[model samples]
Target: PLGMESGAIPDDSITASSYWAIDHESYRGRLNGVGGVGAWAARTNNFDQWLQVFLGMVNHVTGTIIQGRHHHNDQWVTSYKLQYSIDGISWKTYTGNNGSEKVFPGNNDRSTPVTNLLVNHIDARYVRFLPQSWHNWMSMRVEILGCTMNSKFLLKA
Candidate 1:
């Protein structure tokens, strides 16, 4: 399943701080991968704003791709924290100096998206994208990687 089409978005999937509106809709589908040019936008410029997606089921997440909003101009995420939660209540941050709250650097080139390869697998059902800094505005087209829980179970070696 590519995008959010395969996974399920629970009612709690969209608890962001705020949203930005324009010719485009500030919908979550923008992150669903179905939208080749679709994207999700945050209203506030503050770092507290975030977007979280539920994978419907647990998965062994390995990596991710973050595509900036490039309808005409560039809207890229500069710095952010990637977090995962198994139960959706408690969360753990990835990519940081302390190794707890990891801050991942975004794409410097607007024309292309950035791929982040994790050193280890994250087993969780919810993945959250929290923007700490950005170039233009906080907007993104996202792709989650790795396999389903069943695959994790069957492929146990």
Candidate 2:
């Protein structure tokens, strides 16, 4: 849950792109514990166009769920790379054994969401959904599933 009222969405993206079919706030549905009607949209059909959601603190992210626009499939992401960063500017792609950034494929059915479970735990503050390829434009509703930094490790230090 990264985009809910408890979290923050970068304002630079809110009004920066014309491709938004709905407001960016809608991407936080899973954060609110309820699904929302709106989805975040991008202005271009380009690679690497993305949105970032801040959890307000560091977390041990375990997995992620991405739902395409519920009403239709026109602008759904067809493939993407999930990236996380402890500091907003420094990002590391969640990788596979091949050492390349793992590309998670999306569903053609708009209503069915896609998921990515990280190969290893990621201690991060920001997460980004970077589109590799899309049907037309990039749009999604997201849920970042994880928990707060484990205190047991801190105590050990």
Candidate 3:
């Protein structure tokens, strides 16, 4: 479901990706799941016509960066964590359960608006985020900030 309505996903002007094929190596370590209730994802997969529907949920305007450049960010999603992997099948490549280190301009507890989340140096094939909690926040135009580190390849390819 990706917590979004069908009307939300603007399949507008997307004409070049349906037939474009990616290299096998470019698809490594990509299918890893982030932190979330597996049951919820399962329900989404089952009822939502498989997870393929959610592929590329966000519109990439800049070099396929996969940013969720929304109107404003006021979602309850808090405490994001990041992890890495190399082999694609196993997540052996890991650092400390990094939050602030992986994220720039701060650590956890970002209760205020951070002007910039300086995160351009990160180059990984797999990355995951676990929204620990959310505050009293809800909006129609909330954004997910950057896309998964795994999504960067969409641009490079």
Best by TM-score: 1
Q: Write the per-residue lDDT of candidate 3 for residues 1-157, one digit (tens) a residue.
A: 2212223333231111111122111111111211121011111111111111122423221111111112223222233333333433343222334533433221122132322233332333333332223332211111223334334454553
lDDT of 2 at 125: 85
Which ranges of candidate 1 are over 4 A from the true structure? Answer: 5-15, 22-37, 95-98, 152-157
lDDT per residue (tens digit) for residues 1-157 in model 2:
4443344544342222234444444343333223343466676667747756666679888888776665534557788888788878888888987888889887575557777787787888877778787766577666777788744553453
Rank the models by TM-score, top first: 1, 2, 3
Give the distance in Å from residue 57's predicted Cα in candidate 1 to where it truly belongs: 0.7
Model 1 C-alpha lDDT per residue in residues 31-145, reported as the tens digit of each score: 4343434566787678787877777778888877776775655777777788899898999887544557677777664446677877887888888888888877787766677
| Model 3 segments more than 4 A misplaced | 1-74, 92-122, 136-157
lDDT per model, in order? Answer: 0.68, 0.64, 0.24
Candidate 3 displacement at residue 64 in angstroms = 14
Q: Estimate each model's TM-score.
A: 0.77, 0.74, 0.28
